[model samples]
Target: MAKYSRIIAQAGCHIHHAEPAQVYEAWTNPELMKTWMFLSGESRESEAKADVTEGGAWSVVNESQEETYRAYGEYLKIDPPERIEKTLVRKETGGQNEKIKVEINSILNGSQVIVTQDVVFLHHEQLHPKTVEEHLREQRRQTEKYWHEMFSLLSKQLTPS
Candidate 1:
């Protein structure tokens, strides 16, 4: 925790023709998530498991041609079909603690989800050759891209109204 700073990230999407509960289930269900958990491009071989309860554990492993990314964490809060908060630790990020909260709200003919991820990262000088600002900027760019694609795929998974 020493020398680390908090960086909060946000990304969101609306899933058409899907209810809030359906959208939330897709997020917590491991099989449904494997379809959209890739870092980029087409989804690959991935495995996920979740206990889906406060204090329970969850993990996701996504594989690519070059690397295997691992994320594991504990559920901090769970209110079915509405919201979930959890602690997320990614292997690629040196196990940085990322507190992630997701909100599912009802909307016209569908549901909208907002994801808030607050992560702790070591100071740029200590973590990478790039300046801290640059690192954070790059992360934001990637986060945006990843969420856009992920949400698109997630939207396709549900039945249309």
Candidate 2:
């Protein structure tokens, strides 16, 4: 078998106060995205002109004080309140290259939600420094924290009147 460069990372959290379907809705809704998806200090927004269906295209922009990172991906699989799989592609100077597999899953407990992600980093050699294992590791940590914070914010914002 041809040895493919494999990079695996996982992150999970228990949202003890929210429903899995709520989480899923927030994830797929662009309006909800404007409220919680952006981190505390960053100004991020997403423009999703398509549905979250199989073969659908979506885009997200992560904006910081100095720069913005734009990303696009095609929904490969989507099961509401359960799982979402997509082929994530990052924008490069020349074209839309650098593809990776991103999977997001949700588990529920009463009113709680547990979200997990399994990402496979492919085409490692195309990176600037060849491999970004270390950067990716740090990104995983920061991203986990980011999502946790986002859910917290969502919980607060969505509380009943």
TM-score of each candidate structure, all chains considered together: 0.86, 0.62
After superposing candidate 1 on the true structure, give the runs of residues whose Cα lies further than 4 Å from its correct spot.
Answer: 1-3, 123-130, 159-161
> Candidate 2, clashing residue pairs?
none
Quantify all predictions' global Cα lDDT against the true fold: 0.79, 0.56
Q: On residues 51-143, what C-alpha lDDT tens digit does candidate 1 reach at each position? A: 999999988888778778777899999999999999988754666778889899999989998988875655644565456667677776666
Root-mean-square deviation of each candidate, in angstroms?
2.9, 5.4
In candidate 2, what residue range of length 10 has the lowest lDDT sum?
Answer: 93-102
User: Which pairs, if any, clash in model 1?
Assistant: none
Task: Kindly list the per-residue Cα lDDT of model 2 for residues 34-73, writing each as its tens digit.
Answer: 5665444666544443368998886666677767766667
Give the range where candidate 1 is weakest over 10 consecutive residues by summed lDDT.
35-44
